[model samples]
Target: MQTAAAVTQKKLKRNVSLAFFAAAVVFSLWYINFSFSEFIGGIPIFMNFLFTDFLPPKASDLPTYFGPVLDTLAYGVVATVLASVIGLVFGFLMARQTTPHPVIRTVMRGFISLLRNIPFLVWASILVVIFGVGSMPGIFSLILFGSGFLARVYAEAIEEIDSHATEALDAMGAGYLQKIKHAIIPQFVPGYISWTLFMFELSIRASAILGLVGAGGIGSQIKLTMDLFQYNRTSTVICILIVMILVIEFMTKRIRERLI
Candidate 1:
């Protein structure tokens, strides 16, 4: 279906794109000072360490981790609940169809952007510095980051809803709250639940990592064990963490399937 010139042009474009991609990869390797020999040399050393130091996890430490595991779950649950509420409010404000004023929407959008752009660990670290290392900082960090992320996604979901219903409400002289209550809420609930569950999973992982900075969770135990060079204990904690994450993931998937 193509002329010879068109086919040649297509091949030229493909070749150019490949050339650029290869150049970029080469530039990146050079920029990072990557060494093929060093990378090859490290493989056996890494395997040796994995087998000699980190193998055969100390399952004896499992019972001791129960409380910390509970704390991690609590942090995630609390943060997800709080963030969902906050995100709902902001999402309504950010949605162009639902916003009361353009200026308010702009301000809320900027605020949400600020919150979402910062890494969760960075947020945890900052809060730990301000509030003194504890669970509060980690929880607050999850809340902040989750709120931003959920608000953005919620706003997008709201925006994607069929506009005809709201437009009809507008034509019927419906109040803003009436339209939101009758139309937006009904449409948004499923997405809200799904996104909230996803956020909870992320919050759990973040909370665990936050503990490394003394924000308080199972990760604190990990840091302690690693500090003591108790690699076996560290391995045990990691195994527990892996199990917890897998369980949460399974539950979340099941819940999403049922609810959404």
Candidate 2:
């Protein structure tokens, strides 16, 4: 009887805690001036803006946008390629059995962590200051972010693999390179490719935003159009970006399925 009473009390306490949390969220929304009534009231204004400013999507500007679109694609591709290569090397070093030294592993891991934790926008903004507002800054930002991300993924993938092949090679007096070539490479290649493909998708999206900071791409075009109140052109650019992403995603998805 005593235990039953305690259980009831615990459930009531939990329910009360959840009720307070819900109330707090409601209060926060009110404090921030977030109201469904306001949104409903603004619908007519939103529709006016949409029809007056965003319709017919600046189709004539599509030709001029080609260069920036290509630049975005190039940034994503080059950064992903470079980052994958660098990340693969570092990832091997991060693995327990593969690292040349424990100290080196620790340092390499710390560097990868730093790269991944820092936002690409922050990287691009800083690089733009140094590189003077070009695709170079955008590419470098993607490279840094992609390398860190790929290295972490690759390292984890490496750690989870069956060690029997590598162990046999080691027992047969195989050198590190030989073991990597004969055993580790075969097993890790699929995951490496899959991760790299995923990173390419991420890099494309990230590179688009890099242009907002003057690191050239379609984002720069969008920013320019918005500054001039050309939301129609901005909408067109976004449409192209959406199509590009969809195509890339489709291609990468097929490739990943095949590889994995």
Candidate 3:
């Protein structure tokens, strides 16, 4: 089915693409002043620093982190719940199949885009400035970012639902609310739960670091320890964070497996 000229053209295009990719790699390396020798030499230095500075974490400081850890979990839980509710509403508005109007959908899409484009840490920093350093700012930041992300994904999930049920509802002259409740909700619930769980995991990580910006949570402990040149305590906080994340991830995975 292929002509000789067509095959030749395809080969030429492939070669050109490869050449451009190679050139881009070379340009990036030069632009960054990349040095293979320095990169190789840095590994041992990094290892030494890690072992000397971060090893043998201070176990005694664990008791002091209880309140901060709880605050971090609270921030993540509240943010994720609020974000999921907001996302559900906006998701329906943004999806083509469920949208009330094209203009509304476009507006919502733009708003969500704006929220999602701004980094979560940046949101925390800005909010902290407005509200002053506290859990409220960190929680609000996570909610804003999570809502944007979930709204986009939820819209996609809604759009991907089987059309047969919706079509039947339409044929029966069902109202928008009726159609959504009877058709969309059933299909969307599983994916919504899964995505929300993923968002919660991300929120936990984000909340942990929000303290670096004076937003509040266990991350503030990290910042304080680092500021005091207490690497041992810093390592302890980091380990706790790691353990918390791992436990959350494991729980989420199990929940998804059972529910989704």
Q: Candidate 3: worst 10 consecutive residues by lDDT? A: 203-212
Q: What stretches of model 1 exceed 4 Å from their correct place?
A: 1-10
Error of 1 at 38 (Å): 1.9
Task: Report the lDDT tens digits of candidate 2 across residue range 23-93.
Answer: 99999998999989989999999999888998769898689988888888888889999999999999999
Q: State, as a TM-score between 0 and 1, how close model 2 is to the true structure.
A: 0.90
- Residue pair clashes in candidate 3: none
lDDT of 3 by residue, 54-98 (tens): 788999868999999998998889999999999989999999999
Better of 2 and 3 by lDDT: 3
The list of candidate 3 runs beyond 4 A from truth reads: none
Q: How many clashing pairs per prediction, in order?
A: 0, 0, 0
- Arrange candidates by lDDT, descending: 3, 1, 2
Badly placed stretches (over 4 Å) of model 2 are: 1-6, 9-13
TM-scores, each model vs. reference: 0.92, 0.90, 0.92
User: Candidate 1 — what's its lDDT?
Assistant: 0.92
**Consecutive 10-residue window with the lowest summed lDDT within model 1:** 203-212
